[model samples]
Target: MRNTFLKASFMAAMASIGAGEAGAADYRKNPFTLAYDGAITQNEPGKVNIHPVTYKLNGLDIAANVYIPANYDPKQAYPTVVVAHPNGGVKEQVAGLYAQRLAEQGYITITADAAYQGASAGQPRSTDKPAYRIEDIHGMADFISQYAGVDRKRLGLLGICGGGGYSLAAAQTDKRFKSVATISMFNSGRVRRNGYNDSQLNSVQQRLQQASEARAQEAAGAAVLYSGDANLSDEQIAKLPFELYRQGYEYYWKTHAHPNSTFKYTTSSLLDLMRFDATDQIALIGQPLLMIAGSEADSLYMTEDAFAKASGAHDKELFIIEGATHIETYWVPKYVDAAIGKLSAFYGKTL
Candidate 1:
């Protein structure tokens, strides 16, 4: 049995974040348990339909949703896109929103919960490593390319936030994604190694030491340590320094909260995160690339940095949504429309 004290502490921590009772309620009432606005309540003939799926990736079961366009005919090939979710985000959030939107545009799309996060299976839950995240993208491609009505040769990829960064790394050599796109790209490695916007650059070594200690503790069969877990009041959330985080809290905890989504990851995973940079092999991506960011987002620098380094990407473009911030791009109606417009055009031309 797991250590009682550690298990209790973990449960307490989770409780402080948000309640999963609502999610349970959703599942019992709505078969799909979808929480987004305009989500399909039921699959009607000749209309967009969502299929909940589970597949094996490595040895883990990946929970995912596959969206097929209206009047679907499996015999005919359709361009497909593998949409990757943001860090701490689940398939029911922005990823599912985008997948559904893409499906409405007459393309097949899929979004999955990364292994070790959301509803996926893994030990030491929330153990987020770049390799695993990148592999998740590859795993999505492997499954979706072979999906009915999908054109393997015309497959594309869209990574949101942290998923954007991982998508960059995955497409560096995957070659399967003919076109790549990122919305509000976040460089997880840079942020973890340094700090948000290099704010804690001076404490890099100290954080590394802490991460080492966490790993050591885990190796010794001690309790797991997590990072980025927080419980703050509404006023406290408002006082958060960056617009990205302030709005992120609202998006994740208040407006669009979900049972499985969280902001925490294994603290020991920093050992891998500190050394992994999304732009390391970016020049190897010869496919078309489209990176989108909000004009007013403090996290826009990350997208700019990665886009600049994608030297080998053909038809590369950095499109910015006017007057929008990082989190705003996730769900705000106008911003979402802007992003979808750009994505549709890009995928239509490339795929």
Candidate 2:
């Protein structure tokens, strides 16, 4: 009788473990959660529709969210926007908000989980491999081109936050996207190597040494330690940046929220981004380009630098969304509205 009870208990425990796999997989890799106030978009079911889907790229099962306009017709091919999300974020988070709004404005929009993170495939998951991130964007282009009811020839691209950087890199190589835009972007490699605004350039060697230690510890079978999210306490928030990141967090995680999502990010992804540079082929992107950033944004600096260096476009324009911060522009009303309007016009004109 004792043996039978123990056996039954063990079986029940196993069943519960099996039931938690989906959340377990993501949380173990990243415990942080992102918040978004997308009720206006997500719950408003009529004029826009979002479908969840997955695709495989670089051995990663990338998760994506596709948005179709309310007026969408199965018999018609619609212009598509392949979107990439900010770092430490997912398709269900900020990117979906952006894509859905764009869809409501009449464009077929798709946003994806970066490879090695989110629902995408990458073992030793969430390593934040810059190459894999870039590949994921390229993979998305392929994913959309082959999607049903999409006009492959009439495609555009949009990247948000760090995704903006990757999109820039991908667009230089894949001309299938005739237009591209970035919002509150980051040059992941440069920032990883140098720290925000070169403030840590002097510490690159030390940082690299620390990364080596992390690599060795992993090699020796130590559990990975992540530093991306503070998992901030109320006290910590008081001492944090008064702008960009924290404000955005309040909006996305605290107030307006997506129950299925959070701001979680992989622990080891940052170290790999140190070597990633998306600006190497700016001259190669011959399509229409638009960069949207808040003049007051901490991230706007990188956007400005990239715009200055981008060589392809008499067709490119950089617009500073006047009074906003990096995170505010993520899903805030006025900002999102301006962005959708701008993007719709840009793609409408280009594609």
**Cα-lDDT of candidate 1:** 0.90
Instruction: Please list the C-alpha lDDT of all candidates, in the order they appear.
Output: 0.90, 0.72
* TM-score for each of the candidates: 0.93, 0.84
Model 1: lowest-lDDT 10 consecutive positions:
21-30
lDDT of each residue in 1-351, candidate 1, tens digit only = 224433554465356545654432132245676656677889999999999999999989889999999999999999999999999989988898899999999999999999888777787888999999999999999999889999999999999999999999999999999999999999999999989988999999999999999999999999999999887899999898888899888787766766677899999999999999999989999999999999999999999999889999868999999999998898888999999999999999999
Off by over 4 Å in 1: 1-30
Candidate 2 lDDT by residue in tens digits, 19-129: 444321222222222234442334244567777778777665677877888867767899899889887677766787788777877788888877656555555655677
Q: What is candidate 2's TM-score against the reference?
A: 0.84
What lDDT does candidate 1 reach at residue 128?
Answer: 95
Model 1, TM vs. native? 0.93
Q: Pick the candidate with the highest TM-score.
A: 1
